[model samples]
Target: MSGITTSFFLIFAGAAVVASLALYTRQPLIIAYIVLGAVIGPYGVEWVTDLKLLADIADVGILFLLFLLGLDMQPRALIDTIQKSTVVALLSSLAFASLGIGIAFLFGFTLVECLVIGAAMMFSSTIIGIKLLPTTVLHHKHTGELMIGLLLLQDLIAIFVLLLLMAFGLGEFSIMDFSLTLLSLPLFVAAAFAAVRWIVLPLLRRFDRFHEYIFLVALGWCLGLAEAGHALGLSAEIGAFLAGISLATSPISQYIAVNLKPLRDFFLILFFFSLGARFDLGLIGEVLVPAMVLATTMLGLKPVIFRYLLHGLSERNSLAWDLGFRLGQVSEFSLLIAYMAAGSAIIGREASHLIQATTIITFVVSSYIIILNYPTPIAISDKLRRD
Candidate 1:
């Protein structure tokens, strides 16, 4: 218990100090959190060695993040965005996946390793993309809609990739298993919608007057659906996202979304911290060359590919370029896939390290580029910063 207390103290205290310094230095606060994790984590000063506990808690950040995203958009808008962005998302995913596969093969990795790495490369960082976008821009701008739609589509693909990895992990990668897995997704989505329509929405309608109760119920509903997803062999993230989408039509959705931002940030800080803490710094040297090559390639290629794809879809050149830059990074999901694959012995440590190092590098570099060249909430220049 004391250890847990000490860990929390270190995390918050470190975050406060580092975040302040980041603000002063015009750096992304997210980098501060990750650096804090690496500095005090087991491999560093060994101040917070309980990596599993931190990781479990940190996952809630992603859940709430998705939940808020759903609340922000109406169901119709979400559907429209998905419909419009599907082609761009699919094309960009294929391009990035091929790049990853080719690079991994060039480095002498096995076919399975190449495939896993390729799948991991198909996503952009939703957290970074959304968190930095101003709320006003997100709600009113076409760029935001495109970014959100593309990210959501990518997230769906990531879920399927994760499921495939899980099936492989369990040694059940048969044709029947794959078909059943695909079938379960639609069934689970149907069940989620049905429950929301019949039960959850009614409860919310009846209890709307009670603010505290509304908050509690909303939280419970989110977590409950997340657990249900896990039970049904889906990720908790997908479940939480569906929970938010189900509530998007309700009048109280805005209130819930607003109140939950602080909570979401809290968990996200922990998530980033755990991400850094879990990384084995010793393995970095072994994968440094490949990681640099991969990171540089991704940073260069993603923007060009996305810009061309969005332009082909009739988006304005300026908007397409901005959207491309915003998404020009490997995702946190990439790290999750690498972690799971390595843990399951599906990929070697070197492959895992390559993914981790490249992700971190891209994250850092992408943040700098976006803040410097585009409008973000945390831009250094007053002219570029938007509320």
Candidate 2:
């Protein structure tokens, strides 16, 4: 009875109870998912220790999330925003990475540890950023366009950084391989759009009334290209995003987005829960002081840096500040980098755990600040809940 089936029961059942309590206490349900995971996870109650399965599914959630975002994108707008936001993304990432390196060095971490730690800090949480964005603002506003552009650029940079980390991990870096990976983006984009025109649109047009068929095709198209992207040395998220964009001009794109929402949410819960479940609270003491220092500094500093940077580019003070607060957290990519670094022996477990703890702290604190002060999909205040 306590096999995988029971684990599912525990996860969903516990989530329901905790989420209800969070609502009653005027807290975000995201916190409830994390708390439930920690309480029921291996390090706490010693349940659901085999996390590999759930983690795999969690990746799918992210793939679908990016795909959905691409589906909503107006390609021309995305291009213009990308051009405007590229400098912001690069400069802001450089600032955050420098801060991470300085903090890690001051804490007496080794040179390698400091570099890896700083590399991890160069992005923000895609899930958190996109999830919190109110749909009213997201699909229509200039701020939304700019935010998406900046995030996408950071994602590309994260992928490049990850490739270098992989090269370091293997003790063999290849210039040609790196060059090819960079070149693959446009080739893949062209291939995706071609497929949509030659294959997907025709099928959907022919079987427009068969809702189930459209669903299956959309899912297949997303995952199929995700795998394709991975084969081409690009990230699966990028591939899935391209797949979504290929269909963006279709009349059925909105229908596909609406239908996929529930499925996306179901998997996203597992993604957040898996985060809490994987964190070892017992080992946190080793990294606690540094984690607290890093987290607090990042929370206070990220918004200020972003606000000034965006404002310097001619964004209004209010808009720049809002974007800044919204992005003022360490990224999910930080956790991924920590994992990869530890796995590759580029950083020790202690350093990896430091990254995890710092990220979790930022996730929790940054979210509270955003929901309290801004309009979001899950704001505690009725007036602020714009979704």
Candidate 3:
């Protein structure tokens, strides 16, 4: 009857369909959700007219997803990964951004538009990459570790860039703003670290025996840290990540991850599907050429540059190449950054649409590639090592 009610049913039905497809096809569930959204959304048959409601709800899913990701991360592991991943992530981002900007410039896009496009190209799809990597590969191989490492680095970089943009747009770029942001960064980290170390860890130890308590406590830890981070002018995603790192060393980390996974799946499904529903099909006709050009550059050139960068640092070729592929797609961060840019009037609605469309395209295509290659890579790695 109402928009919300109609949206609820559609989301429910769409999620089921996507879930079934994901289970049957062994494809990433996110792609299924996006496909369902595109088919059923306003641009399609108009089966769901209240995509705005769903997008708001999907924000909760994103918050929860980030929270869970935080729970899964370990501080020592993150630091180690960053130290190892810096060279690859840094060089790859620079190279990809340069290529993306050059491509956009060739298309007669403005400097700011090129900057946004460049930023978009610098990141890979965290959701798709994580979802597609095999569990065994994730834990057992140097390639998987490197992929994970670079992704973590990208997340941090994305959050900071968002922060910088916000600070600049808010006209808060004084020495005080810099000092505050800089000081806030480490303080947030230390606060999360301390909370998990002294408070959450003890609570977890006490509650580990009770699955329900463990679950609730994990949720609280995530939201609480996110709220705290928001209060301190940092991104909630960064806070959630720190929260994950804080509890990363806990004995119950694995248990927490396992128990919370279903919740993660439920929320993330809403997220990806909502993304599909928000598509502005009209802009595609106007910006499709640039979007495709940017997408192609990111999907093609990003991995190549990343592999060379890592190899230059003396990393193994297979690991470098694999990590490169894993990190090639434009990230959802690009969408978030474009939103910020739009608010600043630096990028218009058309530019934002271009970014979102290209992001979704890259996300779907890249996930498909990863899923198809995942098993083959494992088998080939074993054979080559033995040979």
Q: What lDDT score is found at residue 56 in candidate 3? A: 66
Give the top-scoring candidate (lDDT). Answer: 2
Any runs in candidate 2 off by more than 4 Å, and if so which?
A: none
Error of 3 at 202 (Å): 2.3
Model 1 lDDT-worst window of ten: 174-183
> Which window of ten consecutive residues has the lowest lDDT sum in model 2?
46-55
Please write out the lDDT profile of model 1 over residues 163-223, one tens digit for every residue. Answer: 8888889877777866776678788878878888898888888878888988998899899
RMSD of each: 1.4, 0.9, 3.6
Q: Give the TM-score of candidate 1.
A: 0.96
User: Candidate 3: which pairs clash?
Assistant: 70-244, 71-244
Give stretches of model 1 more than 4 Å off.
Answer: none
Give lDDT tens digits, candidate 2, residues 210-260: 999999999999999999988887788888888888899998999999999
**lDDT of the candidates, in the order given:** 0.89, 0.91, 0.74
